[model samples]
Target chain A: MNILTINGISKNFGSIAALKNVSFFVPEGSVYGILGPNGSGKTTLLGIVTDVLRASSGAYKFYDGSKPVNEIRKDMGVLLETPNFYPYLSARQNLNIVAKIKGCDAAEITKALKKVNLIERQHSSFKTYSLGMKQRLAIASTLLGDPKIVILDEPTNGLDPEGISEIRQLIKLLAKEGKTIILASHLLDEVEKVCTHVAILKKGELLVSGDIDGTLSKKHGSTGENLTEQKEKTMMEVVSDDLEKLAGVLKTLNGILDINESEGVITVSCHTDELTAQQVNKHCFDNGIILSRLTVKNKNLESKFLELTK
Target chain B: MLHLLNIEFLKLQRNRSFLILIILFIVSVFGANYIVYEVSTNTGHIVHETSNKSFRLFEFPEVWQFVSFISSFLLIIPCFTVIMHTCSEYTYRTHRQNIIDGLSREQYITAKILYVVSLALFATILTVACAFFIGMLGNDPISFRDFRCVFYFFIQALTYIGLSFLLALLIKKAVLTIGIFFIYSFLIENILEKNLNRLNTGIENIGHFLPLSSSDHLLMFDILKTAMRLANIESYAPENAYLTASVIYIVLIGYACYYLYKKRDL
Candidate 1:
């Protein structure tokens, strides 16, 4: 059964639309990722579903029968944008508050702390913790009561590389235990590594949403910002005297999805590995042109990100 | 209800601001009363014997009003604590976090109201004890004659905290909220009430129902009223009217707080 269904959810702040007509469902047991770049309304959408915000014109439902939303929240663990805690309270103290709110046994607080590897410093006040420790404490707080559904917004924020990997593993482990996870991230590498399902949002619009492989494999060529999957394609920087003619001539060739020109050189982007420099040179030479410089190199990250939303 | 109270105290137990403010309230309650009592005795204003006493605020029966009146001003100390308590939830963003965890908005606001009520109860009990101890020190037969002043003090505490709570919710910053509250209570309301009194709009008027004017009227020093009566001056609002208006203000504040909380996006 679907765990959550959002129907035409839209939110506006005065004249600026934060989310517009967004709709998607998270299936039970799937690691759903709400993928978006900065200011893409990922947090706003999550805020609305968690009941800390009100949508301008839509509704959402959790699949846990007809319980009131706050009652439903007790069974669903959520860690929204920032890891806010009473600064004077220790990690254990903060978790105790969370445990009481979620109605978990005090015994589980120890287990949650241990899971996050924070039992060693559990007595340290939250303000004394490093950013990574604070993040781990928040993660441990969400795990209290062993909730069925966990929704996290940028859960890896402020963590070291090891901490990031550890959280990803923890998320995977939670999925294995039949608990559904919803993660919102701005990094495609993060989405590709841990998410089983993804909804790619850009500028308050949902570009696509579904099984991760299906969505990334089919839509990555056009979405343009899937940096992790960009490794599957070939990038050839071709330079010729007549940059405009080369760009036009290369556009006519097969598998050449995009071409860009910079400093009198053409950067041809092909989504297939079969397209190589030789084929491009032959095609150019036959069209009465010779290359000045030819090299296969990395695509400019900035250019690719600029081509993000459709 | 117990769980909710526990949740509030859990945060406050470690908060230095809350602890310091509470300590200040306790100290001010005892210190101010003692200093005034000693000064009155030295100045020959209060006689240990009840008879032939002039301006006997420290004597039996009158001491109840004296202590309550003194504490009405001292209550600002705990009122600051109340403002800090409510504003911290917003400052820390825990109000949103609490709702996200499982608390309905109603529960969050209800927790705050209960906290205010507890503070009022504590302030009242302390005042009553102070009154009882001071009243026992007198040689004359002591009576609980003017004890209703203690009740008025409780209502005044509630009103101060309720208004403080609402202001914190609106302002969301401790310093700014307290600043606005102080200016309104000390300067704005007193000026407005003074001007409204001069207009002579009649005995029954909206000015009588100003958010704080009724509480101020109820807790007015009994000596001040007696001196005014001796000078053939009249009270603009009757005692019962002040009591009724104060209760109405508390009820209205309760609803406005809940309504604002329910509608706002935390």
Candidate 2:
């Protein structure tokens, strides 16, 4: 079932577009993650969904069998940004107010507190709680009434290892219960571990999005071609004053593979993909030209993000 | 509405500062009464017993009037109240959480309005009660006889609370709103009145139309006195103008608040 649909969503702040033509769908009962940099539009997307920020132009619809988005909103709980609570109120009181506002059972408060493992600190004022505790309390508050869709933005931010693991476990457990969770984070590893599906955004534009492993696998495949095929491909970029000379000399060597010089930069692909650094240096030395820089090509999220966003 | 009210009440209950503020208000009212009673007696500004023996403590029928006067400064409470109430939401970033927790834009705004009204009414009720008890000391029987007076205090409080909410909503900063409120309430009005006094003509009357000043005049002076003052200052009276201007101010403020809230990213 489609729990949420956002079509052609665009949001602009002054002249800077925060989100542009961003469209995505969240299937029911799937853990969806939005990955992006600091200025990326992940938070903006979540904000628009929760109705905290109106999109300049877009259509968003949520459904649990033909009910309106408002009804779906009632069923979904969101935690955007940092934990915010009345400093003077106890955790239990805060959750109680949330439950009341959401028109849910007060008993759900206890259940939520238990879910976040904050039952012990439920009676403590928010001000006295630690940062991790406060974050957990926020999660607990969102989990109230057992909302199906939980959108948490950077949930484990500034947490210790133990706290991060605890929250990761909690999120996994929530997903196991068939809850639809949207985790927006800058940390790709965190998303990789917790989310079954991922969307990458850059400069208000979505770069890539789909199943986590499948998406990364496809990106990796582009860089995973055989060494000989890659060698004949002239895939490495080199910049030097004597690029023509370097290309001319590299063309005759047995392991020279393919060399293409364009705009004063020589692209050389060696037959050995995993050659020792010293061997490449000795080859450059025998060529009688400055090597400049040698880098081995590898596919990772960082490189893929750079390639797509750049 | 009940759910909104319940949430507002719960928020108020969780706010320890609110409870402390209530305690302070009660003390301030009692203290103001004691001081006024002592000062009036010492200065012979009032008689312990009237010539007719009907109205006793002071020229005014009740010492609660003095408490009400004191509560006018309690306008400071609401000014600061909305700052802590609304601006803190921005400062602490709870607004996003609030929205995510099923707070529709309308419900959030309505909740604030309801909370402000509730606290304003409570403060007004307590002040009027203080007035009632103090008036009883004058041998005037306190019961439903003075409902109008109490109701007047309620309206006065509502007006201030409304003004405070509007200011806080517009300014969106506690320090700035409180500062502006103080300047508008005390400095600007006094300066305008003094500057107009030099004219020796109708200009002072315009201060009445300004926010809070007109309401203060309506609450403090009787209709005849207000009308006469208006007539003297303007040479002609705009009978419907006062109500019209107040309504316009309220509507404009309400719309502005809603617009800002909806437009703000939060």
Highest DockQ, which number?
A: 1
Q: Tens digits of per-residue lDDT for model 1 on A187-263?
A: 76676777888887888887778887676445454335555555556678888888888787888788887788877
Error of 2 at A4 (Å): 1.5
Docking class of 2: acceptable
Q: Which stretches of candidate 2 lie over 4 Å from their true place?
A: A64-70, A212-303, B41-70, B140-149, B193-204, B222-248
Q: What are the Cα lDDT values of the candidates?
A: 0.84, 0.71
Worst 10 residues of 1 chain B by lDDT: B44-53
lDDT of 1 by residue, B1-266 (tens): 98898888887899998898888888888888888877877765445455465757867888989889888888788889988888888888988989999888898889888888999999999999887877777765687888899999999999999999989988999999999999999989988877776686755444656888789788877778877768876455677888998998899889999999987778
lDDT of 2 by residue, A216-304 (tens): 54533323433223222224565556767766766765665567666667766653444444665576678787778665543345444
* C-alpha lDDT (0 to 100) for residue A60 of candidate 1: 95
